[model samples]
Target: MHLQKDTNPALNTVTAYGDDYIEINKTRHQRSIYFTPEGQIYDLGIQSPFDFTTELLQKITGVCAAAKSPMDFLDHAAPRFENPEQIEVLLIGTGKTQQLLPPELLHELLNARVGVEVMDSQAAARTYNILMSEGRRVVAALII
Candidate 1:
């Protein structure tokens, strides 16, 4: 991991493999994304306000709502899929509180042959980039 200062204060100064990660001095808003070379944001292309609602908000919320515990949001989010490896990392973001994912959900994923890795949304984003850079198949849900 490498860090580089950026001229733009709104952008993250740290660069991992020449990609931006953290952003400073700006209001944190929802639906905002920072991209990395390894991870191309996956747009499931779900339809309507449903897409934005789920991809941007509901998914995160659902994970938290289901967990009923304070855990890192990434713990609930979907996992990343890498080559030859079936384990997936799910990034759950807790906007203002700590939360945990329900055990049943994790089990469901595993039953489907997907490995689960949980992290906060920010870490998930960064990890997504890293996975993408590594040339893994990543699927993300986004509003059209």
Candidate 2:
């Protein structure tokens, strides 16, 4: 699907998506990723939503290895924010299907007051554009 440009072109918007990848701001990402509307995109190397764990968050928090840069696979991307508290909402797109994350995996986010919504990648992409265009502090973690 191809999404029309929003009023806020500077923000990362899902221009198009498919069963295996999502295009953000005309850039194609084939791996799992999390991004804020303000243009922070973090590549989560896990192949499936089932592979998501607190360790991934740990990596972003500087407790583990660095995450891969979506822009350049050979380069490493440093963590921009310290924690999930930076965003008000978290959209978790569980690949081609909608799968609810186990509560244990979300305990950290809930404790940080981040509201999470689980859905399929397509729905997450649509919802992300709407929330982002509205200027809300939203982060989307999509497993492609």
Model 2 over residues 25-101: C-alpha lDDT tens digits? Answer: 88889888888776567887777778888766444333222344577545564333234335777788888999887
Task: Give candidates' CA RMSD values in order.
Answer: 13.1, 10.4
Q: Clashing residue pairs, candidate 2?
A: none
Per-residue alpha-carbon lDDT of model 1 for 35-72, expressed as tens digits?
Answer: 22333333233333222332233232222222333454
List where candidate 1 sits over 4 angstroms from the true fold.
1-29, 32-88, 96-98, 139-144
Runs off by more than 4 Å, candidate 2: 6-9, 57-85
Clashes of 1: 19
Per-prediction TM-score, please?
A: 0.37, 0.76
Q: Show the lowest summed lDDT stretch of 10 residues, model 1.
A: 17-26
- Scored by lDDT, the top model is 2
What is the TM-score (0 to 1) of candidate 2? 0.76
